[model samples]
Target: MHRQSVAARARQALQSKPRASQHRKTRGRVALSNNHRAFRHELHYITRGGGRPVILVHGIAASHSEWGHLIPDLAACGYHVYAPDLPGHGNSPKPGDAQYYQVESLLVQLETWIESLNLQEPPLLIGHSLGGYLGLAYARDHSGEVRGLVLINPLYSPRQLSPVLNLMRKRPQLGEKALRATPKWVIQALVHLDPSAATQFSPQIRQQIAADYKRASPNIVYLTQSLPDMTASLPLVKAPTLVIWGEKDLSLNPASFPELVKLLPNAAGCPIAGCGHQPHLCKHQEVNRLVLEFMNSAAVAR
Candidate 1:
């Protein structure tokens, strides 16, 4: 009997070993294939709660795991949350095609995935960094598709990007080569240096980010090349928006906050003092509160 019990324990550990964390929810993975390149892989995501839908889009080089702190509460609060890893990030299958990294292709594929869900209502979109940029584009294209928007340190102007990204944008070939050459230990060491985690690093989260960063494809550097001028598109994004920023963000300049807010006609700006680029990570409770308040507003009610 003792031997049998030991065998059972070993099997259980094997089953749980693949999961990144114990986020309370049912998770799923949808496969996406780039027809041109013939590369395909699962698009991993978590869906939970029961009332209105809310979709959380994480930034580049990160995964749905970054949304860990925010998910349980949002799920408990009656929101049917959907958090998916972008095509190449997180647990999603990293396609080999460089074109798959293009903003337009990604946006189209993202829309296709959302449409397949056949949501009960237009979702409330909350996006961070590169995800925020994609969210803005989504709102602009389908103004009536989303009830509200929450942007966290979004990538708007290329000028506001972190030094690393700028180098990638300007020197594409070198950037890809360098990214490929970066050792895991170097990335793990650098993860702690991000101002976003200056307050304290959640060991599991920090490790996960570092691992994902190291595993991310060199092709993803291509995303840095094409940033659309949001000046024309911002006005078209009629959905109610809440722009959240971290005063201490090292990745994107905080100065772009006002500029972004000024452009979104129905948007409001929320700047957290001493916060970093990922507000959800730095000030999750505050981020949740603000999102709840916004979702309950009259504009979003309709």
Candidate 2:
């Protein structure tokens, strides 16, 4: 009953072109409480479009701008979008304490954010990389609050993580020291050296990622310390899911998609041919079309 009502409301919203939200990007802050140490933190978000809500979560070292191309597209299709910079990334606060980086703590803070939005109906959650991990966790823990999930090259295993991140997860102090010691150019070289990123990312996309990443919190690596636990929570996610991946995503194991599909109770997936980590930007039209079709089919199913 509730699902159908929400759909009807969405349909009603589509009757008019949502002019106010069209192409206009609004950045703002909201006070959200983190479960870790009961700390209150301010979350920064970018919102665009209006209508049935769609939440976009970017990976570590990235922000809401990661969806620059997709945001306007979704808005034009009559879906309101909210893209947030998870703590320690983008414009959101970076806490000095390590506990705030725990996977559970991040998930709780995200849940609080959704609740505060008073979305009236569940919002579709879409995330990339660590963002995908957060979206998956949100769907798993608060199944009743999400309309569906779209995980793009999501983080699943510690093995899929970068060497520096993996090292950080193992030896916190050494990892911190290494992260601090690594030169900016060396870090870029390590990432770009990966064939996935080296061959695929357009110069424009690469530049954008580089600029956004430079501002990312140094302690951001700690966010993945609880990877195994989050990976274990996968089977518990009840929302219908669409797993999108880039076939050449060395950033996160490309082969992990099939395994992810198997673990999800109600899920489907697609791999973008010749694409790399940033499939949405790498192949915006195809990715956008897939998302539209998936949402349409999901609505019909509901």
Candidate 3:
């Protein structure tokens, strides 16, 4: 009876071992191939159609979720929307050095990603805030690869944000310490200053965004260090560009858009009603309609 019981126990252990191994293999496969996989793997993105590629780039300290409401709406409108979290902001891996977060370095990664995906003839680049700057840079670096440009309250001449941005850059260690020490509630309180920011985001999203901002603050400071000189880069962006600005944006003044439009070789400025800096989030339907209309008009002309 003792031997029989021992044998039974041994068999159960053997079975459990293989089961565990098989379970691990299954999980590994899922992790490796998940649509949202990040890092050395192609930057994770979602696609819904087989049409012209529309790439959405989020601004500083934001993730793909910034474009969450906008992505599906655009995809439903028959666009192949590609929205990925820039490095360190979302699930993507961060480099050991913050210098990698600089605009020049980020642009290199963007180009590599375009080639990695083998985008055919320049994607329709739509960027918000800092992303607008990156999109402009991408169009400049790879002129023919871009079909058109859409700027959503983008950081054009950096002069507007220099005081805060320069302070962080000049004192990275102090800024990093202060950011790390900030309480989650404090971050949320700060966000509440945006007229409709809290209403637009769910509780869970607000927490996650606060965490993201704190984690990526150092990298964001580095990225915006040279933003004041960004205006000179505008002339290189010759694509048919559309600039959208919210009339009551506290984060970015509306006056900047008119000057930005004049700087671009071919650009149109549009004002969004009752919206703040994030029209895409606060006024999604209107934003989508305008973007679709602009894209459709450009498509017809081509």
Candidate 4:
């Protein structure tokens, strides 16, 4: 009876929600104008489809193009997917100040965007790499607003990835250059080296990613060069979580998986076979399957 009642409530909620197309047109205009004014150091985001709202956040030095393959798939599966290029990345305005690049700033912008869009319930927060960490932080900070969380190969700690880079970040000049010079080819080589993630996007898409990165701000790059320790931020997340790791990720030590799993109290663990850092790009079908199953279970259980 309780399950049926919850389903009935969800159905009613869906029925009462505004039409997707109308919301998209209104919200898109608002977001575009906000970006033009360089308001709040916010990022640029694209929304596609309608149904359940799903926000896609990308990892360090990455644009929403990271979710390229999965966006259309998710939309086809009846989700309203919103993917953002965090400030300093893609088309978003990147202020030179490091303070605006902090995780807290991103969270604030996310909250603002959600409110501006007039989304009543918190959307399912899906983040990749650093994005996953942000999702964790956002859920922790705004427990009442989120539906659930999905993290894909997210960074768990600052000390683990590359201590040398972490140390280098202390020197502002070198760090600035490092961030500014981080080319898409270099990033592509680092994560999508394996066969699966390598060829998923066409040359045109690759060119676009390169263009976005070329135009990204050094401040955005510098701040993301070293992953923040999101471990402290984990305890606040109360929603059901899903953590997906690529079996062959060379970026963050795959060994950290067990440690991260234990930290997420409400999380389910899944391994993407034959994939690396960007599983959503490499293993879309498998990822979609896992996500759909997880979401359906959550809805039914509610």
Q: Report lDDT per candidate.
A: 0.76, 0.74, 0.68, 0.67
How well is each residue in 255-302 modelled by candidate 1, as lDDT tens digits?
Answer: 998789998899999998767777787778888898788888899876
Tens-place lDDT digits, model 4, residues 264-296: 778788988787666776768789788878877
Return whichever of 1 and 4 wins on lDDT: 1
> For candidate 3, lDDT tens digit of each residue in 1-302?
23323223322332331121112211101121212222133344545555778889988888777787778877887777777767657666655555455565555455545555545555899999888888887776656668999999887665655455556756666666676688878986777666767676567656766876866645555666644366877887778999998877776667888889999988999998777778887778788888888998944237
Supply the global lDDT for candidate 2: 0.74
Error of 2 at 227 (Å): 2.5
Give the residue spans of candidate 4 off by over 4 A: 1-26, 29-39, 179-209, 224-228, 299-301
- What clash pairs does model 3 have? 122-145
Q: Which pairs of residues collide in model 4? A: none
Q: How many backbone clashes does candidate 3 have?
A: 1
Model 1 TM-score, all chains together: 0.85
What is residue 232's positional error in candidate 1, in angstroms?
2.1
Per-candidate TM equals 0.85, 0.82, 0.79, 0.77
| Clashes by residue pair, model 1 | none
* lDDT score for residue 278 of model 2: 81
